[model samples]
Target: MNRGIPVRLPIGRGGGGISTIIIIAVLFIGARALGIDPMEILTGSPTTTTTSRTERTAANDEAMQFVSVVLAETEDVWNGVFQAAGVQYQEPRMVVFSGQVQSACGFASAASGPFYCPGDKQVYIDLDFFDELANRFGASGDFAQAYVIAHEVGHHVQNLTGVLPKFNQARQRMNQADANAMSVRVELQADCYAGVWANHTDQKGLLEAGDLDEALNAAFQIGDDTLQKRSQGYVVPESFNHGTSAQRKRWFLKGYQSGDEDSCDTFSGDI
Candidate 1:
């Protein structure tokens, strides 16, 4: 998520339609918001700021393990999907940091939210943002956090599939409004991909009751329109780069129901 700044892309939704019998399985997994922005390679000087480091608690350690497990599951799912298509999936690295961290994309604070940097091929996250997502935005649960990770992993998938590179090239010629519109497509596609991940996870019998609801709620809470309404009392549709709450939920449901990456093509038709 971009927070209030325009620096990086942070990177869900929900439910219904096709019904599948879900089995319960025991597995370890882990893991949002700030609004998402279009994918942009970091430019200009590296961001500089005084950094304050906080002591890591036992909870933070456990959170880190959860993130690792979730990431590994994404790798397993994507690898199988890509291999079936005769392609290899390259997994991106995860960087969990405190306060501020420097990336190939630039320096970012915890307040910048979670973002995937194409330059580094790594997803950067400040764990504190998860706290903000639950407390400030009222979106909580382990699955909610997992949705966020899956969304960033979705961007990594985009980069691998060449969707992101093409968008990066095209956006250069676009005005801010046009680019923002295009960005909504990109971000929503990631949301769809996140849904696809959820589908696979559910199929593996990993989803618990209300897990999908947590993801959908997280999607709704961080939507551009919802965030705007909460922060500034109204929305400027033209500035929305991450899609509306409805659009986010709809696309996510589309992917979850279909469980096919082909269904996540937000660049086509009405989006």
Candidate 2:
């Protein structure tokens, strides 16, 4: 492999849905995991909602194994990182859903994107989003997909440490711009966390040639600037909630390079 970044990823092994009567998994901040009866998240309104037809194409099947391997890697890295900090790492469930899924947060379409629902302490992802990565986001490659999952897992780490709840609470009274700015920090830090995971797997000798660049490309591909530029004809700094391409790439690279959690302080980093 070149002494610089690589793009091809090493092999890795690696959801949803329901309507009104769906019983889904849920997570409590300081308590054990809970199950969400779709009825609860929807309030007293008894409504049965149908999912987007659970279709397990070859893509969805392959995406599952891929994410599982990535999650295992994250478990290894974060366990060590949290251990080093004298805390125990709590392993979070990374659920792969096709089409639509119900969570404590509510029903989410694949277009709603991958997200970590703090209430459930689980990472939700629609495997078809992988194609969205390649076709729509221009972020093709398994490593890139792994990066996306790792980023969501990072939020679980943040939630365990109280960072997420703090942000959610803090954002309640803030203006949209300021809230988005805060979101950018959270997302960037998540990117950094993904980087940290990469560094760990690398140290463990899992990365192959072109893998890092695949991740970097994927990372760069999903930035607010790139997405916005693709969707809208322009990039708006004020509307950026996930940082620019440069910032996302920078934070992920920072974590990958340092392999240290201290370097992921996006809250203080300049955009």
Candidate 3:
């Protein structure tokens, strides 16, 4: 056991099952994590809009496969961790949507960004976020995209571990400002989770130089500072639900440096 939190575990495969997949909890943290809204939709909010099902194209399938491969990596790492901790790992599906789609959470447009709905224990992401990564953020690397998926899947890990529901219940009692603050911790922890994935993947010979930077750049470009400056021409600290660029870089680096889930305790650290 690597003491001091940087535990290195043996590497590992994905499982195939016919178990029922459900959308469980969705977190509205940062713009980068905003692709879906699961609670309002799942908790009795009616779908105000409907449309014919959009067909999944070859490109869409390709994108999903890429996400699946990355997700499989998260599963492998977390599975080992869970078994080491004497627990079962719950698997999640990544629902790739375009333009708009119906989810157990609720109806969401692409503008909602990428979100994980615990209501169904699944992740919803609009592939167009890829455009945001490439064209908008200039983080035009495939691994950067993988980082996003891994981050959302990290939320699924939270759900399985019972952290997310506790956070959601806590947020329900919080004011807007406090809620956003809570959200920042959630987002930062997810980023750390993503970094953990990168570290393990890199150990397996997957991550490359520009790839990690691409992930970091994506984190920076979508920071509240960057988004606020772009949308509102100002930075409002009180309303910053996600941490700053420097904070994101630090937390992500921490995860990479430690590569241990036990090190991810942003909630208790006054982050």
Candidate 4:
């Protein structure tokens, strides 16, 4: 599960408020109510100004190394998978930022969490979110961290396969509730794809004991229902852009057990 460090790009101006992290989920849930495009909120930028903040520390360096290793492992697994299907896998870039970053989709703060920009085919993350995952979400472990990276990479896969663009087109014709439902399917499939990567690593003996549990726990922790209930003490199924805890866990487990990309057909089923 170890690999040499890949290139890491640090891009951030300064730290944002701790409340910014809470706003990420709230924004996702309330986007339609507030007349904001959920898709744009998830992937695009706000007003942005570019400035370099290259401050690095030993802890951040270590985090970068871990991220690089996990990303490389994903590349290796996905390359083999795609090659077997007679398609070439295009590796996506991983940007490690501290507080904020500018992406092809738009500008985002660390509070936005990790996102994959299909526009630039890169994964953006604030490494501090891993700490949030451990402390706030209570999903800790290296494999849980890997699950996050792999989930974003799954978005890249969707982009390459035309899933994202097709969904975007479909959403344009739908109402807010319908569009949010579609988004849930998309996000659930990505979770399944992350599980597919887990299956590959497990096949190669790269996963250790409790690795699967860690990933499953992470999946459950970040489910839209779970997040909403934790944040607002209630659940709104109509506003859920991501799947529920049971659905997320089920889809991820399905992919892990099947280890086949085709098994992640969350769109066809009642996800």
The TM-score values for the models, in the order shown, are: 0.82, 0.79, 0.78, 0.80
Order the candidate numbers by lDDT, best to worst. 1, 4, 2, 3
lDDT of 2 by residue, 1-271 (tens): 0111101111121111111011112111101222223233222212112234646566544444445545655666787789899999888765566667777766776667777788767777666666766776666666676687788888888888878888877887899999889888988898898898889877765665666887888778777788778888898989988888888889999999999888888777475
Top TM-score model: 1
| True lDDT of residue 94, candidate 4 | 71
lDDT of 4 by residue, 82-152 (tens): 99999998877777666788777777777778888777777877878888878788887777777888888
Between candidates 2 and 4, the one scoring higher on TM-score is 4
Q: Count backbone clashes in candidate 2.
A: 18
Query: With candidate 3 superimposed using the best TM-score fit, by how many Å does residue 46's alpha carbon deviate from the native?
Result: 26
Tell me how candidate 4 scores on lDDT: 0.71
- Model 4 spans > 4 angstroms off: 1-54
Residue 82 in model 2: lDDT: 92
Tell me, what's the RMSD of every candidate?
9.0, 11.7, 12.2, 13.0
Error of 2 at 129 (Å): 0.7
Model 3 TM-score? 0.78
- Give the alpha-carbon lDDT of every model: 0.72, 0.66, 0.63, 0.71
